[model samples]
Target: MNMSIVKKLKALHQLALSLTCSALLSLPLVAETAWRIDTVASDLDFAWSLAFMPDGRFLVTERTGQLVILNADGSEAKRQAAALPDMFVAAQGGLLDVLLAADFDSSGRLFLSYSCGNLNANSTCLASAQLINDELTAIRPIFRAQPERRGAAHYGGRMVQLPDETLVLTLGDGFDYREQAQNKANHLGKTVRLTVDGAVPADNPFVNQAGIAGEIFTLGHRNVQGIVYDPQTGQLFSHEHGPKGGDELNLLSAGQNYGWPVATYGVDYTGARVSPYQRFVGMQDPLYVWTPSIAPAGMTLYQGALFPEWQGNIFVSALAGKALHRLQLTAGKVTAEQVLLADLATRLRDVRTGPDGAIYLLTDGAKGQLLRLLPN
Candidate 1:
């Protein structure tokens, strides 16, 4: 072959190699992002809430008044029968939420919220205890909803601790007493703020009001199940179930009335109007409303590395809707919505982010499951 032709052929070969390298670099390393159930902790008896400890262990609450500790791999380590509270188990009433104290490592303290009383007379109550050697010791009541009423449902038992170490407990309007949500004198349908020790906060919205409960922070909420605080913005957000329809997600503020039965987008279970209006003067509006009702349960404002794209989004567990709903938020407003894990055909009860940046879920059933969601 001619010398010039040989050199040209070598140059062409180098260019081809470079092109191949470029093409390989542009190819996707991972084909897709998918969510999958990583583990089934057990056939839980109705997993209501899940919280992770600093050592990567987790505790799950069952609505039947059971507290279970599981290893990081979802293997049961111990079950604390003595931790069970004397709960009034009935329709929507029972042992509800469990949370670890912010200083749980140092104090060994945990909190539980449940319905305490018989079906004929019950109320939402908060209690604290020390967990030592698989047992909850020194259990004591911290707060209890006042004007205990007769009912089998509507115990808003979700609890959240703020950065200030103050606690917020949501109370439901006893199903038959929806009107009491508007009354500040009772704890019904209100979010009460208290110190970790259970005393009413000195700066609570109604602390100085003569006729109002000193613990009342906000009122007019109907069975709020999901409550979370955004540490980045210092804002509290909550979602509650409405009658028939009109589930709501609200940006909570001190002293604000989030209109419930008096001003709702939903109607009575019989399809009668709950209220002829969805808004009223002096009452705050929801940041978002689910017209058909999703039965919003557990919620968390996600800020994790598992899904960089999901940063700053909100994750909600849906019971009636039986799905996980993601809301993309911008400047405190939801800009988009997505439904996930609907095909599982299970009622999602709780959602939490793990230290590893993975997502966890609890299913609601007689034989529920603790599930972890991971990228596929």
Candidate 2:
């Protein structure tokens, strides 16, 4: 955030641009796997996330502020639109993550995160809603990233419910606010923990601390889009996008700083280094890093028995890389990695392990698709 550093970085960036760099990661090749792709539904408008209902029906979110319901076979069940709260729907903002409550069967309760506000000022917001009679109603705000930002980019809206039903949501650092990520006063570039009704947990790491957001669960993230709770080891993991390079797979901990602009394996898009330190004191290092970034988005731990080899492995969907990465881990560290379903060649937005032991994916585009990776 210093002017002198900014000026120096600009000059360095210009110099780097003038030189050819061949180190950018190329898309991984499609490899043989124990799965085959099957199209379940298509014609979605930039599908961002998904949640399955107890009765086999599922919900999918469209970035343009639409909540679609689909049958078990991926058949169109409804076309109704949930009321969007005047959200900014430009490049990366809009309706993002959708999740079902633990008591969804009877309570009809659900939660979603979206970009709320206009182009001039906006922030990521988490809201709770209900789906009754296939109609989405009773929408209410639970939390909003503090200090609204000016741009439409970097609203990381990923959500996950822990074993105890506490909700954890990801927030982006609002490109211009990367410096704020290292700060604890606001929600930018952090993960927040909250109760089902939007109450901040009294036991949160930052709770009772002055000058810090009580809801903050972790800090110093750039734009985390993929997060998953691994029940086997009782650990939480997330993967975030780096600038030009330095995509990370991290082990997340409450109140811990993961290091963003202050210490990163990535450089700015202009090719200027983001920081002098790639590993600094008082910051947690990443478990694995994907240099030349894959733009990792959606992730899920394979808990299904259908693929014995894939069981316990983490499956991450990539956007820019246009491939699904399979990472095998041991003690929270990646032991092996591979690319799956590269032949699809589309921006994958989300991935999940369904109750039926199949891997599901939502592609990103105007004609976004709901696809499945069925056992071969």
Candidate 3:
């Protein structure tokens, strides 16, 4: 070979090697963080809610009216069957939500919501009890919706505590009686605010209104299964399931009507229009609405340190969608959205943030699982 040609070939080889090194350097030094589920516990029958105790133990509620306590690592600690109330276990009606009191460390009190009544009729009910020696003590009823109906579905039973330590409980519109959601005379499809002892708050919007339920904080919801309070902004957020479509996320305001059957973005299951208007003069519109329905169940505001990028966003558990939805909110409005755990192929019944900043989830089924999400 000629000397000049040999020099050219060596230079080309060096250039190719340099290009390859540059490309390798541009690659990420470490893999991007991914979510991983650690099955904390399993074999739960239709677990509806998961809450952490002050001592790092966790409580899981089975829809069949049982409470299961687990160790921090998700091992079975104890099962309290007698602690659960006499729930009317019909379709979608049973022991629904369980929550620790804001002052649980000192008070030892916990609250629960469930369906009550016999086959003829049933309604959503709230109760409180103290967990003493791993047994429920001083259990008593706090509130119950009036005029129980025959319908067995749409019992909204989610609870959240406000900054003032007051409680907010969601009630679903009886599937057969959605019109009652618009009537203040009933508790159907309403959110109620009460003191820790179940007394109506003096500042509640409907306290002085005649013929309206004194406990009512807001009216006109379909079947709200998710609720959360943001202490940073003092805002309350809730999501409810709609008929054929029209799942909604609303910034809950006192005394406001949410326009369920009156003004809805959804249609009936039979493909008929739910209402002629999407916005009524006095009804409030949702902050975000999902058409075709995500069947939002449990929700939490992500203020944990495990995922700094998820701070101030909303995490919602979707049942029918079988996914966890991350909703980006800026100044009370949803700016963007993303879906997580779509490949899990399980109906996510509830999502909660643990004391250690990890995410916890409850799967809904006869052989459900309690899952913990951590950095992979």
- Candidate closest to the true structure, highest TM-score: 2
- State the lDDT of candidate 3 residue by residue for 32-103, as single tens digits: 348788999999989999999888999999998888999988789998773545579877988899999977
lDDT of each candidate versus the true structure: 0.82, 0.85, 0.84
Q: How many clashes show up per model? A: 0, 0, 0
Candidate 2's residue-wise lDDT over 1-376, tens digit each? 2332213323433343234222223434334466688999999999999888888987999998888999988889987766867667888999999998888889999999999998888999989989999999999988888889898988889988876788999989999999999999999999998999889887687888999999998899999999987765566778999999899887677777889989999999998889999888988777778887899999999999677778888899999999899987654456667888788889999999998888999999999999988878
TM-score of each: 0.90, 0.91, 0.90
lDDT per residue, candidate 1, 94-194, as tens digits?
78998899989988998999899887778999999888776789898888898889978889999998777788999899989999999999999999988
C-alpha RMSD of each candidate structure in angstroms: 15.7, 9.1, 16.3
Off by over 4 Å in 1: 1-33, 82-86
The CA-based lDDT of model 3 is what?
0.84
- For candidate 2, the TM-score is 0.91
Error of 2 at 217 (Å): 0.7
